[model samples]
Target: MERIKAIGIDAGSTAIKVVGINEKGNIVFYKVEPTSFQMKPQLEKIIEELPKDVPIGATGYGGDLISNATITASEIRCHSKGAHLFLKGPGTVIDIGGQDSKVIVIDQEGEVIDFTMNDKCAAGTGRFLETTAWRLKTPVEEMARFAEKADREVQVSSVCAVFAESEVISMVAKGEPMEAVIKGLHRALAKRVASLAQSLNIIPPILLSGGVAQNPVIKSMLEEELKEKIIVPPYPQLMGALGAAIISMESKTKVTNR
Candidate 1:
């Protein structure tokens, strides 16, 4: 058998993100794929592509499905650890994933002291913007570009996924520009996300993570609304997995030292 390094799997609501770390604690490789209800086969397929000899850790909403992992951690803890590992200090963690958005307050030691989550609805998460984008016949990946072209944002009126769709359609009927509508949708979601972040009462440097962090539209809007700078890691979407990997490697050290 070949010797390998630590691995972390984040079975999130919208996607599965995995990261492999070398012995020196640097990320060596990573992968991300959309989640499916038929997750077992999809997970097995991704695992087959990773080194099999390494200790693995798991996190996120679907973490329990990773029954083979050496340990499992909550998405909140994993994201906090991942952000602190890179930031190397105390700060707030704003993770805007697909199904939910959460603000985590972490100490310099990478421990979560307080957190606020918005899982009761999709209005505060990526799913809200995704639904609006689909209604506009715009691809989710292109939303940032579309919003960037607008000179101003129209009032989205409501952030609820269902209501937002109707609002987008009404704007189109009223000859409103697509850019304004898209920007409005982004702002709508940003306002909800900002509320969650404010609830944590934490300050910058705020680290942004999760798949939705890739979108500059929401990021910029959140910055403008909150008047706070947001720091995004290199692999913004893989933070959860990175944290899990860090814990996995540390766990191995504890065992060896013992």
Candidate 2:
């Protein structure tokens, strides 16, 4: 069978991911960039990097803005499709991105059954981690490592992002270690996500997606809260893009057969 090439683009709040897949669904090329402006230039750059013959599909919050793309998909569908490909089970998906978090429930066939999203606030999303990292004088990438070293628990009682910052400051004033504070931040975020998952009656083998899934501490905290193993894809951030690409291939096959 001749391999059909397809491209998938996930234009997110903070970053854009572009992935190319062969007929066998293996990623042939992948790239990521900061979504500095609207996605036009970013899409152009992605198209330039991919093979010209490949068909392209777009998804994510900025998907509709990329008018030249062949097809656009909802971020929820993309994330669920991508996570299901990797996790392979009936479960819930919690995706914490730069500015939002979403909980999606998937059936045994990898279809999205239901979903909830928190796009209105920064409290339960990656923005919380970024804010905490800034205040702790640590890079966001190092947060998980720092959190793992926490020797004692530090409670973050505020649900508001602003109030949580103030609360973290008070904990620091009391000589709380940075590790403990970071751990608390992870736990707090996990608790909110777990609550969302619970609302849908969380099934086993929960899958975590988005950039935050790369953080080991958040994954560990989420697992602890859910009392089940959480699955993280190898390229968690690119799952949406991969899902769009897979969808594009399927669509093209149908058109050709018809």
> What's model 1's overall lDDT?
0.85
Clashes of each: 0, 0
* Candidate 2: residue pairs that collide: none
Query: How high is the CA lDDT of each candidate model?
Result: 0.85, 0.81
Candidate 1 lDDT over residue span 182-239, tens digit each: 8888888889999888876786788888778999878888898789898888889999
Task: Work out the TM-score per prediction.
Answer: 0.94, 0.91
Best by TM-score: 1
Score candidate 2 by lDDT: 0.81
In model 1, the Cα lDDT at residue 92 comes to: 92
